[model samples]
Target: MKLHELPDELHDLVHYSLKGGSEDFPEMRQFLGVTVRGDANLIWNKYKKLAKHEDKTAWREWVAQRKDSTAARREADEKRELLETRRRQIEERLLEAGWEAADLKFKPWSDGIQQWHELVEMPKQPRPLTDRVWKNLYAKLKPLLETNREERIEREYIKRKIRRRDWLEGVLYKLKRTEPPPLLKVKPRQSNSETLSSVFRSVTKRDVFPFVHDALKLPLIQQMNEDDIGIEEFREGIKEHQSKVEDFITDWQDKTRVYLVNLIQEEDREYSEILQPPKNMDLDAFARLSDDQKLLLRADSLFYVDTACFRTLMVDQPYDYGTALQTAYPSLPEYQPYDLGTEPVYEPEAPDLTVIHRYATAQEVARDLLEDLGKPNASFVEVNQLHYSCQRCHDKSARDWTSMLEHYINHKQIQAKVDKHASLLAEEGIVYRNVHDRSFSNDRPMIKPARRSSALGARVPVKMCKLCERKPIDLNVTLSIPRLEKHLLEVHNVNDPKPEVHYSLTLASMFGPSPGSDYEIEEPDEDNEEVEADNAPEEVPVEYYWPESSELEDEGEEEWAESDLQ
Candidate 1:
C-alpha cells in the first residue's frame, strides 16, 4: 500500500520510522490509541516495504544522520555532567579555604554571572590599590581559577571573557589574517563594541570610540606598545602588562593592572605626579620651574612668585620673551650729575621717586608731561612694591614703597586732589607723608618703622569680606591683614593667590569692588541707605569709612595720618 493510503495514525508512524530507519510498532499502536486492540504486524510490514522500496540510500543516510545526532547529544550530556562535577570539586576546595560565604557567592543568583563561573574579586583591599596587590592575588589564585572543563567547552562557543584580553589580542591578530576566521568569538565582540561606541558618540557628541576592533586597546596596552615597540614585531611585545600578570599558565592574562590602578586610586601613578614640598628650594629655582608646574604646585606654597612682564605698544611687532630692550637699568656712577667735572661720590644709585611724584602731582603740569611722553604707551613693570614715576617727564619720584596698594586707586581727578593736598601739607611744614598712611582709622595702628627683625615688615592689603562680622573690627580681626586674607581665601574665595602686580593696576581688589566679589563697601547712598539700615542689627555699630584723612571733608586737621617721622 502507498504511504498516504494507510490510516492517518499508521501513515505518520511509517513517515517517522522512515526519518530514522527505525520502527516501533508498539509505540505506533500506542500513538494511534489502539494499544488495547492488539496486533500490528501488517502495518509494520507495510512500513518496512515503504522504507526498502522507496529509497534505500535515503534510508541509510537518515540512519547515519540519526546515529551522529544521538552521539552528539550523549557527548553534550556527559560534558555537562563532568563540568558540574568539576565545579562542585572547586567549590569544596574553596569552601575548605574559608572564604566568606557572601564573597564565594559571585552573582546575585539571577541576572549577573554565577560564582563558580568567575575568578576571585580583584583588588580585594582598601584604596590606593596598586599593581602590587594584583600581582599578589593572581599568584595565589592562578591554579584554582584555570579549570579543564571550562576550557573544553565554549558557551555560545566563545571562551570565558575574564583573564583573556591579552590572549584574545593575539588570537584576534591571527584571526584578522585568517580568511573566514572563527566568527562566533570575533564578530559579536566587534559589533557590540562598535554599537556601544556609536551610542557613546551619539550621547556625548564626541569622537571617542571604545574599541579599535574585536580587540579593545587599553591605555596600559597602548603604553606598553609605545615603550616596547622595536625594529621587529614580536609576540606579546606588551611587557609591562605581561610582567604585571602573575599567571603564566594561561596565555590569556587580561593585562589590565594599570587600567585598574587608574579606576580605583585617587591619583594615577603611571600618568600623574603630585608635587611634594622641597626641603630647600630657592626663589630663583622655584621661578625657573615650568608654568604648568607652578599651577599644580600652588605659587603661594613656594616663594614670592610674580612675573616680570614686559609690554610693548608696537602692535605691528609681536612681543618676544627674550627681548631685554625695555629693561629699567639702575643708575650707576656713569649716570651721576656733574657737580664739577667729576661725579659726586655720594650720588644716589637711582633718582628718588618722591621727586617724580612732586612733578606728576600738578594736574596741568602732569597732563603736559604725560602728553609729551607720547601717551606713555609701553612700560616695563616689576612686581615688587610697585611705585609710580614719570621718568621721561619728571625723572623724580618717591622711593617710598608700601605693600598696601589701595593708595593708587583714583577717579574723577581724585589723585590730583590728593596730590594738591600733599602739596598743601608741604606748605604747613609737614612733608614726605607716606603714600599708604592709615593712622586716621580708629581701627588702624600707628605706622611704625619696621626693622629687619620686625614681624610687621612688608605687609599687603587683603580683600575684606563684608559678611564676615563674627569678630570685632580690631587688630586680631579684620584689621589683621594676614587674618583677613586667610578669611577671604577660605570662606569667600575672593582673593587672588598670585595677583599680577602692575603700577596702574587698581587697588579696588584690596579695598572694595573686584571681579566676582560679592562684598561692597557699605556707604550711605541716599537711595539704598534704608535697605541697609533695615538689615543692620540694632545693637551693632556701623562700619567706619575706608577713606584716608585727606579724603575726608572735615577730618584733615588731625595731622596724625602723616609719615612716621622716626
Candidate 2:
C-alpha cells in the first residue's frame, strides 16, 4: 500500500519504525502488508509531510464548517458590513477632498527605490474606525492630490526632474573618472600657477590646482612625470572627487600656513634668503633697503591688495569699481584704495596666531632645538617618528617629542610642573640626542598611532557612528560630528554623545559623499515640513502599517524613515 493509504493512527508508529534501524522497517511492512521501500527515512519524511499538509487542510475545512454555524458567521458578516461602510465613508471623504480612491491607497515606502518588494501591500483585514487614521490618511493624500492647473504644473515638474537627473548623472560621470583631473593633466612645462589662473578663474575653481599640487607634492609629481601615477593612488584621489579636492586644498592651506610660521622662527635662515622683491621691483633698490624695510615689504606682500588695476578699469571705461571688484574676487570682505606709498602692511592671519599660541613655549623650544640640531625644516611628523634620549637626565630610554617635552619640564625643579611645563627653557637642562645612534635597539621609542592636535578640532567634517557599527547598520550616510551626535541622540536614545567615544577619528579617504551632504534626500522641500497629522499614529493598530506582528515589533527599532536618515 502507498504511504497515504496507511491509517492516520498508524502513521506515527510507521514513521518511528522507519526512522529507527533497517530491521524495524520489516515489522512495519508486516503490519501494513506492503513492501518497505529503499531509504525508509526518505519515504517516512515524504509521508509525514503529506500527512501534516492533509491534517492542516482538514483543520482549515473543519474551521470553515464550524464558521458556517450561526454565531461566527453572523460576527464575520457584521465585520464585513462595518468594513464596507468604513470604505464608503473614506471614499466619500476623499472625493469631497478632491481625491480619487486610487490616490488614497498606500504607496511604496521609498518612491526612489521603486522595486516590487518595496511596494506596500494594503491591509486585507479592516482597520478599526478612528479619527487619527483618517487624519493621517488625509494629510498624506492632500499634497499628492492635484487640480487641473496643479496637474499641468506637475507635468512641467516631471520635465525638470528628468533634466535634473540627467545633469546630475553627467556631473557624476566626470567625478567618477579614474584618470587624473583635467586640471592636473596639463602639460609638464606649463606652470601650475598659469594653469590655475587660466582654468580655475572662479574663486572655488582657482584653489583646485594649488590644492592638488601641494597634496601630491613635488616628488609625486616628478615621479608621475617620469611614469604616470599608480592607478590605485590616482583612483583614490579621484574617488568622491570634489570632496577630496576640497579637503586636500583646505589641509594644504593650513599646513602651508603652519610651515610659514615655523619658517619665521628659524634664526639660521635670513629674511633675504626666503623673501624676494616683487617682479616689478629693481634688485639693487631691494638690496639697499634696511632689514626693517625688507620686513615691511614682506608684510605688504601678504596684506596688500592692489586696487590700481580696478581703478584703471573704472577710469578707462564704463565700469563700476565696486561691481568689477566684486565680480573679480567675491571672497574679499571689502575693497580699500591706497596711494603708492600707503600700501597696507601685512597683518598675520588669525590661523597663524592660533598656530603660534598653540604649543607656546614648547613650540619655541622645539624650534630652538631643531635649529641647533641643524634640522630646522623638520616637521612635527619627523619629530614624533624619530627617537630622542635626554642627555641632561642621562636616561638611555627613547622618547618622542611629547614625552621629551614633559621630561624637560620636570628638570625645572619647580612646583606645578605640569601646568608650567611648556614654559621651561630648552637650554636649561634638556639636551637630547637622536636615539638612532644609540647602542640598544630595544630602547627605541615605540611608534604610536598619529593623533591630530586637539587645537585643530574636527577639521574633517565627515564622521562615522560607533553605535551604528555596533548595531551592524550601514555607516554610509554623510554625517558630520554634530549630525552624528544628533543621530545618536534621536535614533539610539544615547544622551550626550562624545565624538571620540561614539564615532571614528578615521578620515573617509574613499568614495562617498562629502560631510553634511543630503543628495539621497531628493524630496527635500516636501518632507522638510512637520505635519502632525501625516505621522504614523502613536497607538494605531499594527495591522494597518505592518501585516505581520513580527514586522510590527521590528518597525520601532529597525525601520528608519528616509528623511530621518538623511
Candidate 3:
C-alpha cells in the first residue's frame, strides 16, 4: 500500500503532480497519499472489485471529469442564465401576444446547466430563436392571424406574390442580377448531441465535411513517418498525390459550376426568363467558406419565408392588417423591380391552360403536369425529405437533383411520356395551376426571352453528355443522362445538388408522339463496378516515367533495334 509501490499509472499521476513542474501539488500529494492508506484502499478495492475494474483507468477518468467539471460548471451556469433570460423574454413576448402554452413548445437547448458540447463540438451552437422554434411561433401566429384578421393575412400574401414577381422581372433585366429558383432551402447545420427522442429542432451549426475531416485525423494517419518506417518515398508520394488531387478537384469544380450555369440557362429558354447566377461571383464569401460553403446557408432557409413581419404599432391594434397595410402605403410608391434599365415591352399572349413549367428537374415538370391534371393539391416535398431509391445507379440516393431526375425520367421514358402525359391531361380537361400565379397577369415570366451570352446557341442539342461538355464537339452531351451521371459521381466529388453548388439542370426532348416502345436503359452491374474502381484511383497520383523530349522520335527505332539484337 506504500505510495512509492503504487501502480505506475497511479504513481506517475502523483509524480507528475508532485515532482514535475506540472502544478503546485499539496492537494495532489494528499490525493496520492490517500490511495495507499489501508482504510482508504479497503473501500477503494471493494468498489473496484464489485465494479469488476482491473486498472487505474476508472481513477484516471474521475480525475479527467473532475478537471472538466471544475472549469465547465461556471461557464455552464453563465450560459444557462443567458438561456433562461432569453426563455423568459420569449415567454414575455408570448404573454403580451396572448399565445397559448401549446403554441410555444421549446426543445430544451441545454440539458439542465452543464453542456460538454461547448468544448467538444467543433462549431458551437446558437440556442435562441432557431428556425424550428421560429416556425413553431409562426405556426401559432398563422392560426391567430387567420382567426382574428383573415383579410390582412390574404392581403399580405398577395403583396408577397407581387414582390416575388418583381424580383423575377429584375432577374431578366440583369439590372438587379438574379438567382435560380432554390430547389431546396438549405441552412447551416448546427451541432447537437445525438438523441433518439424525435423532435424537430433547428440546427445552428453542421459540419459539411465531417467524414472527410474525421478520416484525415485518424490515428493511422498520425503515425505515418518517413524516417521511422524507412519509407522516405511515402512522404513524397503523399505530397505528389495531394498536388494531383488539388488539380483534379479544381477541374471538377470548374466543370460543375459551368454545368450548373448551363442547366439553369436551359430552364429560362424552355419556360420563361428565369434567374441565373451573377456572371462574376464575388469570391469574398466563397474564399471565406472554402469547403464549408455548402453548410453556410442561413438556418431559416429550410422553408421559404412567405410571411414578412409588419411590426407597426398599427398592426398591434385589433384592426385588419390588409386595410392597415393598404392605408399605410396608399399609392404603394410606384414599385418596380429594376432601376438600372427601362422595363422591356412585349406583346402578351393568352394563358396556355396546359400548365407547362420550365422547371430544371423531372420532378418539377411531373408536378406541373400533375397540377394541370387537376392534382394541384399535391404538397411540395423538401429536398432533404425525398428518399426514393434510384434503380439506374444501383445505389440509394447518390444525392443530387440529376440522380433524382435520372431515376424519375428513366421510369417514365423521358421525351415521349412528357407529350403523352400532356395530351392525356388535356383529354381529361385538366386546367393548369401555376405556383407563381399572382394578382396581375404581368407576374408571368416576360414574353421577351431572357438575353444570354450564347443567344442562338442556348438550345439543348441532341445526344448530350451530362458529365463533360465539349462545346462545339459534343453539344448534346446531356442526352446521355446515364453516362454523364456515372462519370460525374465517379470523377467529381459532387454528390448532392445543394443551393451552394453552382449547378443548373433542364429537361430536353423532341416532344411529339408517344413512341412505339419505351427507351430501354441498360442497367449493367459491371459498368457500376468499373465506375467505382475508377473512383479509387483519384486518391493516388498517376506517375508516368517520360523519356527525354529529344529522344521521343528515336524511342520507337531504339526499341526495334533492341528487339532485333535480342
Candidate 4:
C-alpha cells in the first residue's frame, strides 16, 4: 500500500520504528516486504529517512497531541509514585518518633506530639531544668499545633462539603432524567347532596417539600434577572414559603397520628406505655408527657406508623418508598452533612418486627436489613459476601441486599400480595446467606459485589464481563463489578445488566501451596557428618541472655570461650 494509504495501525507502527521503537532495520525491511539482498540495507535506510520526514510532515499536529498525551501519562505516574514515596516516608518518620498508627488516625496533632514526647523522655531520667525546657517548648508549640489542627480540620470539612454538594448535584441530575416519584394525594370528604363530585386531586411536589428540604437542604440560588424581585429579596421569599411548608407538614402529621391512634384504640393493640403511666410516675407527669414521647416509649408501633405515613406523604408508591426513605435519611457517610464537630452519637433505630397484615415491601425489607446491620444508612457493601434469597419465590438465585430490595418491589406476585395486605397469611420468608458458603448449592448464581470508595489498601473484587466472552475481544480484562457494568454500557451498548447473566465473578485465589510442598519441614540427612554437625544442638548465645543484675555477686565459675561466630 502507499505510505499515506496505509492503515493507521501500520503507519503508526512504521512511525514508532523510526522513533527508535525497534533496533533491527533489516527485520523492519523484511516485515514491510522489502526483502532482497545487496543494496536492500541502503534502500531500507533511505526509505526509513523519507518515511520519517513524510510521517512528521503529514501528522505533525497529531504527533504533538500524542506526545502531549504521553507526557500527561508520564506526569501522572510520576506524581503517583511521589505520593506513594511521601506516604512511606511519613510512616517511617512516625515509627521513628515512637508514634503508633492509632495515635495519628484521629487527632488534634497535639495528642500524637505529646505521646511521642513522653515516649522519648520517659526513659531518659532527665534533670529538672531540662524537663522544664521541654515543657516550655511544648507550651510554645501547643498553640501552633492547635492552630494547625483547626486548619487541617477546616480543610477536610470544606473538601467533604464540596464532595457532598457535587454528589447531590449528580443525584439531582439523575433524578431529573428518571420519572418523578408518584404524587401523594388524599380523598376529600363526601358531600350529603346528590352531586357526585370526584374527591381525588393530585398532590403537587410542594406537598412533600418539607421532608425533602429537611433531608437534602440543597442551596437555593436566585435567577439572574427578574422584573420585581432582586437576588437579596429571594431569601425572604424562601423563608415565607418554608414556614408554610413546615406548617402544612405538621398539620398533615397531626391528622395522620390521630387516625393511627383511633385505629390502634379500635384494635386494642396499643402498648401499656401508650395506654397508662408507670406505677412510679404521678398522673401530672403522665399528663405532661407529649404524645410523641408516649408513642416513642412503644417505638415499634410508632415506627410502623411512621414508616407508613412517611411513605404515604412522600411517594404514595409501594416500590418507591425505599428510595424516598433513602433520600430522607441517607445512611452513607458521604451523603451525610459534613460535621465539623465530633461525630454525633446516634441511637440505633430498631426495626419494627411486629408483623403487619401485609407482605413486606422494599422499604420494610431494607429497613430490617439496616437495623440488623446496626447502621440504618449503610450500603450493601457493609454486609460483604452476604446475599438474600426469597423462600416464597422458591428460586435458588440470590441478590445483593440492594438488589434484593429491588426484586421484592419488582416481583408482580409479591406486589399483588402486598397490595392486598395478605402477606402475613404466608410465611413471607427471606434469608441472607454467604455466597462463599460451600454448604449452599454450587450451581446458585453469585451476587454482584458492592462498589466501594477507592481508599488506599481497599481490596476490590474482580468481575469479568460475560458479554465480552461472546464477542470478538480479549477475555482477560477483569474489572470490578461496578466497572464491568459501566464497561458493558459504554462498549457493548448494554444497559441494565444482570450480575448472573452479564457478568461472572473472578474471586481472589484463597488456595496457596499445600502444607507439605515448599513450606514443609524437611527430614535431616543423618548419613553426612557435615549434615549431622549442621543439625547439632547449639547453646543459647550469651548476647541473647539478659544481663546479670548488678546486685548479684559475680561468680568466676563460667569461663569465657568466645570465638568468631559471625
RMSD for all candidates, in order, please. Answer: 34.5, 27.1, 35.2, 32.3
> Clashes in each model (backbone N, CA, C under 3 Å)?
9, 1, 15, 1
TM-score per model over all chains: 0.16, 0.24, 0.18, 0.20
lDDT tens per residue, model 4, 170-235: 333333223222121112212201122122211111111223323233233212112223212432
Candidate 4 accuracy as lDDT: 0.36
For model 3, the superposed segments whose C-alpha errors exceed 4 Å read: 1-232, 240-244, 267-363, 366-382, 385-566
Any runs in candidate 2 off by more than 4 Å, and if so which?
Answer: 1-124, 127-360, 371-385, 391-397, 406-566
Per-residue CA lDDT of model 1 for 29-139, tens digit only, reads: 324432111224454564466577666876556555645664565456545544565445445555576643333432222222332344333222223223574455445
Residue 536's lDDT in candidate 4: 19
Q: State which candidate has the highest TM-score.
A: 2
Please tell me which model should have the higher lDDT, number 3 or number 4: 4
Alpha carbon lDDT at 559, candidate 4: 26
Better-scoring candidate (TM-score), 1 or 2: 2
**Between the candidate structures 1 and 3, which one is better when assessed by TM-score?**
3
Candidate 2: clashing residue pairs, number: 1
Error of 2 at 152 (Å): 22
Q: Give the per-residue lDDT digits (tens) of candidate 2, residues 312-389.
A: 431121111112222233231111212112353221212222211122334444444454444444323223333345
Ranking by TM-score: 2, 4, 3, 1
